[model samples]
Target: SSFPAVLTCKAAVAWGPGQPLVIEEVEVSPPQPMEIRVKVVSTSLCRSDLSAWETQAIFPRIFGHEASGVVESVGPGVTEFSEGDHVLTLFTGECKTCRHCTSGKSNMCQVLGLERKGVMHSDQKTRFSIKGKPIYHYCAVSSFSEYTVVHSGCAVKVSLAVPLEKICLLSCGVAAGLGAAWNVADISEGSTVVIYGLGTVGLSVAQGAKVRGASKIIGVDINPEKSEIAKTFGITHFVNPKECSESIQQVINRITDGGADYAFECIGDTGMITTALQSCCQGWGLTVTLGVPKVNPELTAHYGILLSGRTLRGSLFGGWKPKSDLPSLVDMYTKKEIQIDEYITHNISFEDINQAFTLMKEGKCLRCVIHL
Candidate 1:
C-alpha cells in the first residue's frame, strides 16, 4: 500500500523553555517494518504537555502525546494491524524484550523511556523535522501536528465506537488517573480515599474510586470551584486546602474516621504530595502519586506514617498495558461508568494550543482537547 505523499505537517515547536511554541512545517516519513504512520484526527494539549514545554524536555519538541486517529500505513512484520485501522497512539512504547516489558508492566518499560528521549525506530533519528532539521520525539508521541509516526509496539487498536476526541484524553492524563486507582492503588470495596489536586487526573481518580465502590471519596484542592467539578465525578466530599490548610489533616481524619484508606496526589506539587501521604489512615493505607513535581521528586512526611504500615508508592502511565487497558476503559465509557464526554470543559483547535496551555496554568480548564 505505497503511495506518493510528501506528508507535510505543521506542528508546535518550542525553541527553548519560557519561550513560545511556533508551528513549523515538517515532513513525515512512511512507516517502516514494525512501524505505522498515523494521520492524527484529534489530539489534546494537556498539563503534562506544558510540563515538557516548561522543562525544555527536548529541543524542537513536538508536543501533544495524547491522540487518536486512523492508521495510514503499516510497515512489514506488523501483522497485528492493517491500513485504515482506527487506533490510539500511546506515547509509551514497549520493546517486549526488555525486563520491564517481560514483567507485564509495559508502562514502566525502558523502551518507552528511550523513545521519549528522542530515540526513533531502527534509524536512530526522529521522524519529524524542524525547518528541515530533525526534532526529538517527546514521550514517543508528537501528535500535536496532523500526523506522527510510531513503532507497532506503541500503536494500540481501539474500537471505532469511541469518539476520537474523547479517546485523545486517554493518551496519558486520563489513563494515568484512572489507571492509578484501578491498577496501582486498587481502591478496595467501600474504602475511604482522598485525592489531592482537582484536575482531570484528580477527577478521574475520584471517578475510578466511585466505580470501585469507595464509600467516601474526599477531594482536596486550593481552588474551591474545583469542588463542584469533583462532586460531579462522584466525589463524596470536597475540601478547600487554602481555607483548611491549618487543620486539613484533622479535617480529613475526622471525615474518614482516621484518614483515608487510599490517597492520590494528582497535582504535581510538593506540598500536596506531603499532605496526601500524611492524610492516609494511621496504618494500612496506600498513597499513589500521579503528579510529577518539578523538583525534588523525593517526598517528606513523618516516618511514623510509613512505620505504622502506610504505603507510599509511585506509578507511571497508570500501570496500563495500552492494548488491554485502552479497550476496558472504552467499555467503561460506553457503560457510562466513566464520563470523558462530560469531563471536557473546553475544546480548542490545533491553532490554539498555546492558549490551552495558558488556561491549564490558570487551573481553569478541566480538559482542552485539540481537534485535528
Candidate 2:
C-alpha cells in the first residue's frame, strides 16, 4: 500500500519542559516496516501523562497513552492490521517473539529499550517533526496527535461494536486496574480488599475486586466527595484520610479486623507506598503499588513489615500482555460486564487539553476524554 511521504495533521506538542501543550500543525512520516499509521479518534488524559509533562523529562514529544482509533495505513511487512480496522493504542508493546513475551510471565518485551528512547524500534528515529525539528514519541503511542505512526506490536485490533470514545479508557487506566486485581493480585472470592486513591484507576480496582466476589471493598481517599462515586464501583466502605483522627493505616487496620487481605495503591505517591504496605494484614496480606512514582523517588519502609509475611509488589499495566489480554478486556466492556461511562467526567476537544490537566490537579474529575 502506498502512503503519503508526510501526513500533515493537528497535534498537542510539548516544545519544552513544563510548557503548556500547544495545538498546532505537525508533520507525521509514513510508517516504516512493521509499523502502522493510525488516525486517533478519541483519547483520555492519564495521571502518568501529567507526571511526564510536569517532569519535563521528554520535551518536544506528543504525549498520550490511552486511546482508541482506526488504522489509516499499513507499513511493509505489517499483515496483522489493515486500513480501516478499529484498534486501541498500547503504551506497552508485545512482540510475541521476545523471550519475556514467550515466557507468559511478563509483557515487558525487548522492544521496551527502543520505546524508552522515544524512537521506532526498527530504526532509532522519530516519525514526527515540526518544521523539520524532531518531535519524540511518548509511550510508543502518541495519541495526542490526530495521526500517529506506531509499531504493529503497539496497535491491537478490537471490535467496532463499541465507540472509540468509551473504549479508549481501556487502552491504559481500565486495563491497568482490572489486570492488577485479576492477574497480579489474583484476588480470591470473599476476600477483603482495600484500595488507596479513588480516581479512575482506584475505582477500577474496586470494580475488579467486586468482580472477584470480594467480601469487602474498602476505598480510601482524602476527598470526601469521592466516597459516593466510589460506592458506585463496588466500594463497600469509604475512608477519608483527613477526617480520621488516627493515621490512615490505623483506620484501615481497625476496619478490616487486623488488615485487608489485598491492598492497592493507585495513586503514585512514594509515601503512599509504605502506607499501602502497612495497611495489609501481617500474615499473608499482599499489597500492589500501581502508581508511577516521580523522578525515581526511593521507597522506604521498616524491615519488620516485610518480615511479618506481607508482600509488596509493583504492577506494570496490571501485568497484562497487551495484544493477548487487552482484547478480552475490551470484549468485557462491550458485553457490559465492566463500567466505562461512569468514569468519564468530562469530554473536550483536542485543543482544550490543558484544561484536562487542571481538572485532574483539582481532583474534580475521574477522567477527561479528548476528542480528536
Candidate 3:
C-alpha cells in the first residue's frame, strides 16, 4: 500500500527575532515513528510564544503551541490515536515509562520534556521545511501552520463534542492556572489568595481558587480595567501597584490582615516572585510561580521569608501530564465546571495572527484564538 505524500501548506514563519511572521507555503513531512500529524483547527496566542518570537535566537521558526485539532495521520508503532481523532497539542508530554511519570508525583516527562531547540525529541529533526530549508518548531507543536506534526506523547486525544476553538485554551493557559491552584497549591476553602498579574493564567488561578471555595481571591495587575472582567472569574479584590501608595505587598498584607494564605506570580517577571512571597503569610504560606520569565531568571527572596515557614515552588503546564490529565480538564470544561470561553477575548483569522500578538503585547486581550 502507498502512504500519503508530503503536504505543502500555509504556515506563518518568523524569519528572525522580533520580526513579523510571513505566511508562506511550507512543506510538512510525514510523521516519523511515535509521532502524529495533526490538522490544527484552532490555535491561541500565548505570552510565551510572544516572548520566544521577540527574544529567542531560533529563527525561521513556526510558533503556536496552545491549539486543538484532528489527527490527520499516525506514524509507525502508534496505536493510541487514530486519524480523525480530535486532540489538543501539548508542549510538555508524558512518556509514561519515565521515572517521573511512574512516580505519580511529577508531570515532567524526561523523554519528551520541553524542547528548546525547535526539533523533535525522537530524531532531533523538524518536520517543517520550505524549498529544503528547515523551519524550527516552537514547543514542538507549531500550530501556526495549517498542519503540524507532533510526537504522539505531545498530543492528547479529546472528545469530539467539545468545540475545538474554545477547548484549545485548556491546552496551556487555563489548565496551567487551574492545576496550580488545585494540584500544586491545593488551595483550601475560605483561605485568602493573592495572585499577581491578571492575565489569562492568573485569572484562571482565580477561577480555580473560587472553585476550591476560597473566600477572598485578590487579583493584582497594572491595568485597572481588568478588575471588572476579573470579578467574573472570582476575584474578590483588585490591586494596581501603580495606584498604591505603599508597596503592593504591604497593601496585600494590610488588606488580608497578615498576608494571604497563598500567592501566585503569574507575570513572567522574576522580580515579582519575591513580592509574591512577601505577600503570603509567614506560617504555612505557599507561593507558586507560574510565569516564564523573559528576563532575569534568577530569583532573590530574603532568607527570613523561608525561615518563617513560607514555601516557594514552580509550576510547569500546571503540573499536568498532558496525555493523562488534559482529558479530565476537557470534561470539566464540558460540564461548565470551568470557564474556557470567557478567556477568548478575540477570534481571528490565520492572516490576522500578527494582530493577535499586538492584542497580547498591548494587554488588550486575554486570549486571541486563531482559526486555521
Query: For residues 13-70, could you state the per-residue lDDT of candidate 1 as single tens digits?
Result: 7778757778788888777668888988988777777887887556877877888999
- Weakest lDDT window of 10 consecutive positions for candidate 2: 111-120
Candidate ranking (lDDT, best to worst): 3, 2, 1
Clashes of each: 0, 0, 0
Off by over 4 Å in 1: 3-6, 121-123
Candidate 3: segments with Cα more than 4 A from true spot: none
Worst 10 residues of 1 by lDDT: 112-121
lDDT of each: 0.80, 0.89, 0.94
What are the root-mean-square deviations of the candidates from the true structure over C-alphas? 2.0, 1.3, 0.8
Q: Could you give candidate 3's per-residue lDDT for residues 1-372 as a string of tens digits?
A: 245568999999999998999999999999888899999999999999999999999989999999999999988888999989999999999889999999989999999889999998988899999999999999999999999999999998888899999999999999999999999999999999999999999999999999999989999999988999999999999999999999998999998999999999999999999999999998899999999998889989789999999999998998888889898998988898888999999999999999999999999999999999
Give one digit per residue, the lDDT tens place, for model 2 in 283-325: 8999998888776578999999999999998878989998988
Order of models, best TM-score first? 3, 2, 1
Residue 283 deviation, candidate 2, in Å? 1.5
Q: How high is each candidate's TM-score?
A: 0.94, 0.97, 0.99
lDDT of 3 at 277: 94
